[model samples]
Target: MNLDDDIALAHALADAAGAVIRPYFRARFVQEAKADASPVTQADREAEEAIRALIEEHRAGDGIIGEEYGAARADAERVWVLDPIDGTRAFIGGRPIFGTLIALMIEGHPVLGVIDQPISSERWIGAAGRPTRFNGKPAGTRACPELSRALFATTAPWFCGGFEALRSAAGDTLLGGDCYNYALLASGHGDLVVEEGLKLHDWAALLPVVEGAGGRMTDWHGQSLHKGSDGRVVAVGDPALLPQVLELLER
Candidate 1:
């Protein structure tokens, strides 16, 4: 498949997700818990359905793995990963930090990804072998050589058991930004973001975005993250800080 065309489709998929998600943001949409006890709402289902429609229209042979809808066509060579709202808790709490994550996975690796924030009208697209862009302009990250000098963030502290250590290592740890935290890291607003319990859909799109913007992300073991990763995450805006940051988090 032509990656350029797939990137465009990823962007459009993100847009489709937003069209359904915006109306329900902070609005009373019936929410229920999945078997995992995570929240799922009409917005999530509707958004994934919308994206699925677009993919079916464009790449019917491709597969899908979504938060709301489980995997489909699991053996396909190409797959689309969707997390309609990467920060559903923030969305339910009326915060705009939540985002729609869309990724095009080829043979279990993300080749194109997009993080779309409907409320803010912001979008970040990162495609392998291409420069990352924030709202169509080149976006790059700032470098911070030391962990203590870094501004760090995470979806929340309690999600990770070693949160206190990570906070101590960074000098400061701010809570609650989900995918926005990664976007912040990509845009150079935050230096690092760490989280645990992320699924493939949760971190796949952010991986290329972070790395494309002169940043890097990996599982806690400092190995490259792939479809089967266990979901312990560490993302850094400056690649130089990855080792020390991983050292602290892993310890």
Candidate 2:
């Protein structure tokens, strides 16, 4: 398969999904929950359905694993991992930090990823062997040499066990959800993004974006993430800073 062609398609799909989601964002809407107790909104379901329909029409054989509606067509070698609205809480609160996340996994590895923040008109896209870009400009992680200078973001304090260690290492901290933090990390704005309780959809779309931007991402144990991860993710711009943060967290 031509990876670039696939990545471009993924980027277009993400943008389409974002357009479907942007209108209902923060608007009056009903809220509900999934079996796992995560919040779901009208925007979430609508966006997922729109994206699913588009994917089915264009790539009939590809599988899809979505946050709002669950997995479908799971046997295909190329699967799309999607979080229709990565930061639902932020979206509900009228914050523009929320985004639409889409990732293509071949075999068991992510090959292309896109994070579209419709509210801000910002799009980040990356592929395994291609350059990462933000709104069509090449982007990369910052060059922070030490942990003390790193800016960190986490979904929440309760989600991860290594908060204290991260706090100790990072001079500043910001709280946010899902792909937004990863978007910031890839755009050279944030130095590190660490979280726990992540699912495949949460980190899959983000892996290529981070790695393509000269950063590193893995589970807490420093293992490469897969479709069945236990929901822990640690990402940083500089490779040198990763081991130090990992060592501190593991301690």
Candidate 3:
């Protein structure tokens, strides 16, 4: 499939997964703890299963790496990375910040991405070499220039190695999870988002969205992100501001 077709397929998949997850938002459900002590609910598993099923049926030869179910069909050149419900804690607590994240990674680089927030009725899609869009209209990142004027965000304060330094740099901070912060960054509503303690599924889908919207998405070390990375994720609106922040972290 061509890039547009692939991006369309990803959007469809994200919409389908959102359909499965939206009903559970703000509704009480059985919540359980994973071995890692993170919370999981029927919504999380069911949404992931739904997305995986779509990928398996529609792109049978492609591999998948999902947050809830782990990896499947690992050797395919094109892989679908999924985070069915990126902000489970927010979902469980009746917050609308949660969303479904999906991406197509071809030969290890994210080329297409979708972040669907059903509650807000917002969907952001991005593909390599194409403009980023929100519900089909073009979108771009905010134009914050320096740390002193930037609005930084993260899932929590403790996730990044340079949390103290970043907090000190930004004019304001928005504490939240992956997809929500990514959406804000893409919409020109937030300037920077730093995430640490992430798996490939968490960051993979976000790379295309951030980059396509004229922003930078990379590990804290100023290196490109990969499936094997476990360091902090630093996303920023202006590419010019990223290296400065990265250098601060490296100090």
Candidate 4:
């Protein structure tokens, strides 16, 4: 497969989503709760529609798995996973940290990912065998000297276990960025992100971004992530800290 072509299409998908989402950022619109009680809005539905339309136009053979819309042609060798508005809570509250998550999975493994924050105009792109780029500039993670001095982050402590331990071990803690936290980690703005109960749409796009930016993303057990992974996730910008961090998580 020509990865460059897929990467270009992914960017177009993000652009389509962003165009649909920008106008709804702080505007009054329909917001409804899903079966899981998570918020879904008009922007979320329309953005996913926008992205899906582009994918059908450009890559009709590829499969699709989306947050607002269900799966289609899911058994294909290549699939596009999308979460149009990953942090709807933040978006509804006028926070710009929410993002559109897009990932291309080959044989159920993520090989390309994009995290785009349209309101902020920040985009991070990562592909297998390629270094990550943010806003078209190479992006690399900062060296995390040690776990104790790390800047730990999570969307919400309740989403995972061992929060208290990690919070105390790290130098500081920041909360509530959802997919944006992983993007920040890719850009060296944070050291780690641990969360759980994420669906395929939630975490699939993150693997390439974190790993491509000189970091590691895996289940709490330190195994590589895939379609069947248990929801718990750990992302460390400096790979060496994974063991120490996992040790605390296992306690």
Candidate 5:
């Protein structure tokens, strides 16, 4: 499949999601607690369904793995990973930091990805052979040499599940960014992001966005992240700093 076409489609999917999600944001949309105690709202379901319908209409053979909806056509050469509202907690609380994540994974690796922040109207796009862009301008991560100097951010320490050592090693960490953290890292606003307890939908889109911006993203052990990853992720703006960061987290 042509990658450009796929990239274009990914953005359209994000736009479709925004159309459903925008109205619900800051409009007092009622939220429900999922089984995991994470918040879910009518906006989340409707947005996913809207994106799903578009994908089905355009790319019928592709598989889909959504946060709100379960997997569909699990075995396909192409798959779309969707997280309608990556930070539902932030959304329920009327924060614009929440974003819609869309990724197109072909034969197991993400080739196209997008992080769309509807309220702010800023979108970041990354593809296999393209420069990462923020609102169509090329962007990349900033450099930070030491842990203390780095502007670190995570969703929450508890979100890391049991990676307490990793969280503690990050020094003073910022509170939350959900998908926005990766965007910040990509656009040179943040230095590092460490988080855990993520699934495919949560981490897949981020891989391309971070790496395409001349940054490095890996599992806790410094391995490549993929579809079946266990979700211990560390993203660094400068590749040279990864080893030191990894060492600290190892402690």
Candidate 6:
């Protein structure tokens, strides 16, 4: 398979999702509570449908794991993981930090990922063996060797363990950026991101985006993230901070 072809398809998928999402931003819409009590809106469902439709038309054989819709052909060798609106709360609150997350998993490993912020029209695409790009320009993380000098980001404190310790250790902290935090980290805007309770669709797309931009992402235990990860994830713009971050997380 031509990797470029797949990468192009990934961009198209993001475009499709963005098109569906832009109209709903800050517009009147009803939000419903899911079984897990998380918010879901029409934009989330419609955007995922748009993305799934494009994947079906172009890559019919591939599997799909979506946030709104359940899995289809999940055992296939190649699967697409999608989260139409990763930060529904932020989206509902008219915040632009929510993003559309898309990832192509080949044989259970993510090979490409896209994080698209529809309202801002900022896109970050990352593929294995290639530099990450933000709006067609190469994006990279900055060097911050120590946690005390890092700018930390997370959506909420409840999703993280040792939140107070880590927050206090970091040089600066900003809250509420959902998947966009990873995009910022990839673009040298942030230094660290740590969160828990993320689903595959929530984080699968982040691995490639973070890793391809001179950053590292792993579980709280410092293991590689995979389909079975426990949802505790930590991302650092500089890998040197991982050990220190992990130590504080264990406290």
lDDT of the candidates, in the order given:
0.88, 0.86, 0.86, 0.94, 0.86, 0.93
| lDDT for each residue of candidate 2 in 126-153, tens digit (9 for 90 to 100) | 8887779999999899899799999988
TM-score of 3: 0.96
* Candidate with more favorable, higher TM-score: 2 or 3: 3
- How far in Å is the alpha carbon of 156 misplaced in model 4? 0.9
Candidate 3 regions exceeding 4 Å error are none
Q: For model 4, what is the C-alpha lDDT against the true structure?
A: 0.94
Range of the 10 consecutive residues with the lowest summed lDDT in candidate 5 = 161-170
lDDT of 4 by residue, 47-81 (tens): 99999999999899999999999999999999999
Candidate 1 per-residue lDDT over residues 1-251, each given as its tens digit: 78888988888888888889998987889998988898888998999999999998999999999888889996788988899988888888899989999988888888888988999999999999888999999999998988888888987777665787777878577888889999988998999898898889999999889889999999888999888999998899998888987777766
Question: How many Å off is the CA of 148 in candidate 1?
Answer: 0.5
Candidate 3 vs candidate 4, lDDT winner: 4
Order of candidates by TM-score, top first? 4, 6, 1, 3, 2, 5
Best by lDDT: 4
| Cα lDDT for residue 101, candidate 3 | 88
- Give the alpha carbon lDDT tens digit for every residue of 77-179 in model 5: 8999999999998998889999999998888888888999999999999988788999989989887776667777888878664345545555556888899
Error of 1 at 103 (Å): 0.6
lDDT: the better of candidates 4 and 6 = 4
Model 5, residue pairs in steric clash: none
Error of 3 at 220 (Å): 1.5
Would you estimate the TM-scores of all the predictions?
Answer: 0.97, 0.96, 0.96, 0.99, 0.95, 0.98
Residue 205, model 5: lDDT of 90
